[model samples]
Target: MVTTWFKKFMGKRLFDRYYKFEKMLPVFAIGDRFCVTHAEPKTHYSEKDIVNALVNREIIFNLTWTDNGQAEIGSVVRYLYDFFPDNQEARMFGGHRPIPISQNYLSRAGGKYIQIHNPSWYNIVYVRDMKDFLIYRDIFSILPLAERLAKKEEI
Candidate 1:
């Protein structure tokens, strides 16, 4: 009963956030300097062009939302072209699942699940059907747990 109202109230607002990239605050390490990288060199864009593109791209899509949405080159994100070949983690990724959240997570989380933040690794998205996120919403979220259990050598 209460859950229905909550969803009704939020409605599109929940999905709207997915479009706002700049609003997504940058997560920084204690002493980490913001950096960006460009993994692939296929793009005709020069160093400066890539950096500007990254920021521009950041505004429309959620950079941290998906593996591809994120810049593969951490350097492009943190250092820009000033240190391109030197920095490589910022490989700019370009991919998207245009399906709505409901259809998108149908395989893993249906529409009700949300991927929670993880301390040690990437986000492990969950859906309402599994009931996993309900009991262990925070402490044992999928992020590191899934990776840790999946393989002893992956990480």
Candidate 2:
């Protein structure tokens, strides 16, 4: 019915390498798994400003494509150099390339993510999101206290 590619798209090898790279960082608690406040699309923050946002700092390293679904390597490249000519790292590592995202990954990655224009390229997960995946075992968490506080403050 299905092929191995679909099954392993985000599994095993990728997860192993990703986990090995990330395990070097200090561990965080479950409450630290999500952004305390919402993050704007990368389109909103400048290079310096995004770094200052305290949470979701990975957005600073990503390409922010505002145009809908024009996901091609050439198109992404043009947008990158035009928007961030001064950036040297983006020219070298294809790390920050932003492609059109599916609704599915958004539900998983939560705060911020980047898709590769090419399906073969791995979808870029934000550092915190990757942390949520490896640590919390789920990106979304149940925050009853925060929910109650919000409801009480609304009245």
Candidate 3:
């Protein structure tokens, strides 16, 4: 089953990160492979703030519909833009698009992620999120993050 394969992948991928658990929990795969933190979300950030958040940042996104089971529950793409970047322009998976995530969402991205309202768009050339993606310090170490997660908790 794909479930077994995903667990294997996540285990190997997260091995160097977190402390081991007595019993391994089940990990879920949806949207894409990204980090999920415990930061707080901001439902009311000023327009100026968001604009500044995504300036000069190139994003990388492997989008799929929320229509499927993977679509709705797992919405935001949670990756460390600076998970291992050594330059100003971070390695993003997608361009900046307007995201309206709940504060719960922001916290998961460590308040470092931007929610994409309509993530179904294919080619996001010259978008807003590309500009202000500077949360370098917020980028978590995989090992530490893994230490925080023994198994996939859910979306």
- Number of the top-ranking candidate, with TM-score as the measure: 1
Residue 85 Cα positional deviation in candidate 2, in Å, after optimal superposition: 19
CA lDDT, every model vs. true structure: 0.33, 0.34, 0.29
- Per-residue CA lDDT of model 3 for 1-155, tens digit only, reads 65466568777556434425512321211122232211212122332433343331211011311221222222232223223233333232322332333211112232334332333222122223434534333322243345446565442
* Model 1 per-residue lDDT tens digits across residues 1-155: 65466457876576466436534543211112112121212223444554355456542233333442233433233333344434332222211333243221211112111222333434333233322333234223344556676787455
lDDT tens per residue, model 2, 23-43: 443221112222211211334
Q: Taking the candidates one at a time, how many backbone clashes does each contain?
A: 26, 0, 28
Candidate 1, 11: how far from true, in Å? 4.4
When 1 and 2 are scored with TM-score, the better candidate is: 1
The alpha-carbon lDDT assigned to residue 106 of candidate 3 equals 17
lDDT of 3 at 11: 71
Cα lDDT over the full model 2: 0.34
What TM-score, over all chains together, does every model reach?
A: 0.25, 0.21, 0.19
Q: Give me the runs in candidate 3 sitting further than 4 Å from their true place.
A: 1-84, 87-108, 118-155
